[model samples]
Each structure stands twice: as C-alpha cells, then as structure tokens.
Target: MSQADACLRLNGVTNKNITISNNVLYCGSQLSIKATNDLTGASVYNNAVNGSISATGIQSCGTFAISNNVFINATANNFYPAAGSPLINNGANPFYQALYDYNGMSRSLATPTVGAYEYSTTNNSGCATTDNFKCGSSTASVPQYSLIS
Candidate 1:
C-alpha cells in the first residue's frame, strides 16, 4: 500500500516498446514512474495513480502517448469512477489492440475506458445474456444489474 521510493521507479534502464496501462497503484508516499534516464519507448497510460509521475530524458519515446491517467486521493474506499466520470470512455485504443482489462473481460474497440477496469453495460459473468436471475428462480421478470465488479 505504501513505499519509501517510487512505486514504479524506472531508473537507468534502456528498454523499448514499454507500455504501462491498466494498473491500480495505491501509493501513500511515492511517485509512480520517475524514469531518470536511459528509459525509452515508454508509454504510461490508462492507470490510476495516487501520486506523481516524472519522466525525464526519455529519448526513444518521442511519440510516446501518456494519456488517460487518473490521479486522485487514495483515501476513497473504492477506485471506480463515479457516475459521469471523465475516466469513462476517455482512453484511446492502443495500437497494440489490448483485448482485455484487468478483470479479463472484453474491451470495446471504439471507446475504451481508463483505469484497470473497463465499465461494461452488462455483467461479464459469462451467464445468460438475457437476464442474470439465479438458477431455479420463480420470477423471470426481473433484470439483473448492469454493473460488473
């Protein structure tokens, strides 16, 4: 939950095609990525960070896209964005075409949400698409909630 140093400190390392996405970092007192130097081709996007991010002297990432990051207070009980949050449907689809979220559910191609989870209109429990009524239920008129955990 906390660390003395940066949660994702990338120092003095050379790498390419480094894409950081869909992560939930709850750091009490640390930065996310303070890449000092030698790090390249790094794209930090679609993550929930409770701290700061500093990337200096990154050479090969001239076109690296750092977008759709949620930086907020970690005191909240849950990390999900509230209704009509800017984090919803705010991220651009990566060129890599990330197929799944942290929950292993499918992602929308047109408008992908930010953070580690993707908000879906239907629960992704792989149940019947029509209704989420429990098995052997009497009443079939009720519709299950659309929000997935």
Candidate 2:
C-alpha cells in the first residue's frame, strides 16, 4: 500500500468546488485526496484518513473550511479511533449533514464526532456531572450520552 497510487486524484482542475467528507481512508504512503492547482473552493470535513492530503492553490469562499478531520496512525493496515477517544464530540456542525457515517449509522446535526464513523460510546469518566465537558481551558457543551446509541 505504500507504493500505491492516490486513492482519489484530481489533476489540473479549474473553477471547481470540491467537498470531501465522512469517509475512511487507509494508505501506507499514497495520499488520500490529491488535487492540483486552480481549485476555486473546497470543504474537507469530517473525514478519517491514515495518509496525508494535498491540495494546491485552494481558495477559501468564506464557507470553505476544513474541520473535524482525524488523521490516525495505521495499525495492521487499518485505521480506527479507539474507545474513549477524544475524537468523540469534537466535530462542529458541517455545511451539510451526510445523514449517516461511513458505517451507515445516523449522524446528528449537533455535536458530531470527528472521523468516519460516529462513536457509539461515550466517555463518562472525565465528563462533568451534567452534559458539559471540560478540558483544561476549553469547555465544550455537548449532548449527554450523544455518542451512545
């Protein structure tokens, strides 16, 4: 997989708006999404990839944002977030909800997790007594047990 070609390749594109989300990509050395120059607008969100992503001259159309993406280390030719991972509920509301994750599980509009699959388990050990979650200087107010089914 290290010497494999790009998973998704777009070369010499112009005046195009690209959006890549809610997918799991695993590779050894191949790039996940490779876009050449002249990209007008792009939104790369809510994706889990084990390899790198490269885009040249990508412009921001105000709505252009890259958030909620997870780059995890590959293990045994697979990439997956562990249980009780901080990736849960770390994602913000996207421009459009895909309605489901890579696993075809329903995804909520509020407090979406960062990655391909929505974490179906919640880490209640470090959470506040209420629905709030705190981490050092950051205080995130997420739905209680939202990760759980």
What is the lDDT of every predicted structure here? 0.53, 0.51
Q: How does model 2 score by TM-score? A: 0.52
lDDT tens digits, residue span 1-149, model 1 = 22357767766656656776555555556676566675545665566556666766433322222323232222433344444655567766666656665446677777877665566642333222222232334453423325358
Displacement of residue 56 (Cα, Å) in model 1 is 0.9
Provide C-alpha RMSD values for all models, in order: 10.5, 12.4
Give the clash count for model 1: 0
Candidate 2 clashes between residue pairs 3 or more apart in a chain or in different chains: none
Candidate 2 local lDDT, 15-118, one digit each (tens): 45666555555545677657666444666555555566676643332112232223233332223345555556656575666566544566767877665556
- TM-score for each of the candidates: 0.55, 0.52
Candidate 1 matches the true fold with a TM-score of 0.55
